[model samples]
Target: MGGNQTQTQFILLGITDSPRVQMPLFVLFLLIYIVTLVGNVGIITLVRVSPSLHTPMYFFLTHFAFVDICYSTVVSPRMLADLLSEDKTISFADCMMQSQSFTHFAVVECHLLAMMAYDRHVAICHPLLYVTIISSRVCWQLVASSYLFAFLSAIICTWCTFGGSFCGPNRIDHFFCDVVPVLRLMCSDTHSSEMVIFAFVTINVVGTSIIILLSYISIIRTMLRMCSAQKRAKAFHTCASHLTAVALLYGSAFFMYLQPPSSHRSLDKVASILYAVLNPMLNPFIYSLRNKEVKGALVKCRRRFFNHWQQRSVVSSRT
Candidate 1:
């Protein structure tokens, strides 16, 4: 009887209790998910169809779009579903999978963004050697390295979190299967696990951000030495988009993971939402709107799509 009561209480407490915010949160997340899908898919299609965007920079951009789609898909659908459902229960296996997928994409995004910085760095600092430096082989290697890093990070994180014993209450607060929320539900001592998570987060977030910063710093110094206002401005314009992305990603991640868990869980959830949902939705727009090449590609793709639709419509009408 005691065990049964304990289990019942745990289940009730573990489930999401924020009923009033459910509908509003659901609608908000649904809209964001739609926007994320459209923006990322649009970017992927534009990059693929546009011959002018076949270069390395646009290659990385396409990968970023793909990562964004994966990242948003990892968390948003489940989150949206949880909002509308009365029982916000996720199976232990499902939770672990969600956690792994989320972590993988999140880490991959960091590396991808860092690679973007390196690309800009090469383009700006070694304009003459840009082609030689970021060759097709080198680009593929960097992309593969990013994926490997993401996978390793995810493995470590999943092993750490899933190793914990969740005897009863399996409810994860917030929208998705984040490390902290899952750790909180653990019945075992999670101090060491949390520390390991913090260490990995630091390495992935702070470490990557530092490398990106150094690359950009070197690029900027080299540009300053060149003293060509037009070239410097152009480099800055290109770097600005990447820098914004870095700031959003690292800022949120560092804030969420670096702080002590007790005081900052709510803040972490909000910050996580920004990068997970908002960043993905914003990335394509930032690139397309600000980048001349991307904008041209997007415009060309749109015209083609519209023309194709019109042709189909005409055929249907004739039929």
Candidate 2:
């Protein structure tokens, strides 16, 4: 923004301008968006109804799922709609809203994954103190703090992103209003804004990643010291799923933010899709399919639902 001559709106160039690909891309991502919402929401519901899943691990997981849904929604809906509509124009106010909202949830996801790793670490490495350490009160405080940190970080990031002049180049190359893409459009110097946003991204990604790495190291040491073979296997199995999600999420996230803004729009867009779209959609499956406990909880919930429905049907027939 020129502070005075900022464009009122922007035209999003989207994934592709070709007519041949737009419909196909629209259908493809629409399905992904559906699965992201369903899978994340379903996980939240499963945790609530399943008593066995009410522990510190699932507590963090519930919030992670929520963040995934929210962050993905910040981009996917608008992107998908733009795929179909001839006009992909978005107002300056709307672009800033999208940018800030995405930042909020993205920070939330990073911390929640780190928190989940810590929860597992306590459960495995310090089993005797797990109950005392990761108590209900502590878990809630962690979740609350994650949101608070995200809120503050997003405000600063959004402010810095639009702090420069955008009097020219009213077209954003990507499908959505991401910080880097929008930064490239600025008519004014974007070095300060890019650095500020990069610092925030680094702190959230690398800082949280360090916590996860240390927790896993301690957990591995504890697992090795265990005398029983069965306990070690069980611990490894539990850690595997969390590691998968961490890789899927952080790999793209680091690729996107840890470096300077790229001139290659295609590479940037692909990285964005991985963390922003694919990560959220795949998390529920990754977390659930790998864990025996989540599977067992799902079975119990299904049975309970069927039983309740049967009871209602029997009473209606009697009447």
Candidate 3:
């Protein structure tokens, strides 16, 4: 009777843990997960192998590609596995670790997107000063600072959430161990913890979002003043890609977090899908399709890859 009671108390959670949506959702996410990996990996490879693609813009873009890959990996695989399992239960320690890593990657991506915007601003508005303004040292510092802040935020949030109690029924309803879902599982009073999470989310989403808006405003104003139509058009095109990425990321994130708790859980799963899965998949296509340089590099990389393959075939045939 004691064992039966203990077994009954163990909570299982997530969308796929239900019978209604398991197979359909699993197939859908499997496709999305594959596309995300291929797209991000292709972008990274294209940027790395093409020498002409070396610039502050592509440098940051390469990192963005890597971050997208890491971000998706942090959540999607486990979520996919959970889809196939009968019991979608995560251990307390596993849940904490997932929350920490997911938060770290998500926060870093927020700042990194802002930094990319700043890069675009300098490149477009201060073409003469672009080299000096975005020097290697400055770029490295920006990347380093983004990672440092993300790590700090993740650590603080993890401490706040994980140190609390989970007395019973430890089920997280969403795919990954996000703050809201995990907090819902805790038995302890989580007012302070929720506040901390809210503050951090605000900084990453709202704070960086304001900065991005301001930068783009300045960029648009500067572009309007430019004498050359060609240059202005180029600047607008370059800025559009970054703008789209920023809009999608912050829009979904804010929608998820800014709402009252009553509305959070219902929207949590959908919001998590945007930044965690779709945003990463879109990042590569945004960069490649919008930026002439990235498109050119991709073309070059494809040609080279095929040429190398053909050469190997020819050599084997001759031998």
Identify the superior model by TM-score, candidate 1 or candidate 2.
2
Who wins the TM-score comparison? Answer: 2
Residue-by-residue lDDT tens digits, candidate 1, 166-276: 676655566787887777877778788888988998898888888898998898798888767997788788887788778887888888878767666456667988888
Residue-level lDDT for 69 in candidate 2:
87
After superposition, candidate 3 runs with Cα above 4 Å error: 1-12, 17-20, 310-319
In terms of lDDT, the best-performing candidate is 2
TM-score of candidate 1 relative to the true fold: 0.89
lDDT at 81, model 2: 90
Number of backbone-clashing residue pairs for each candidate, in the order shown? 0, 4, 0
Query: lDDT per residue, candidate 2, 1-319, as tens digits?
Result: 3365458899999999999999999999999999999999999999998999988899889989999989999999999999999999999989999999999999999999999999889899888999999999999999999999999999999888877778888999998999888888888777888888888888999999999999999999999899999999999989899999999989998888888885444798899999999999999999899999999999999999999999999999999
Model 2 has an lDDT value of: 0.91
Candidate 2 Cα misplacement greater than 4 A, ranges:
314-319
- A best-first ranking of the candidates according to their lDDT comes to 2, 3, 1
Q: Extract clashing residue pairs from model 1.
A: none
Q: After superposition, how far is residue 114 of candidate 1 from its true place, in Å?
A: 0.6
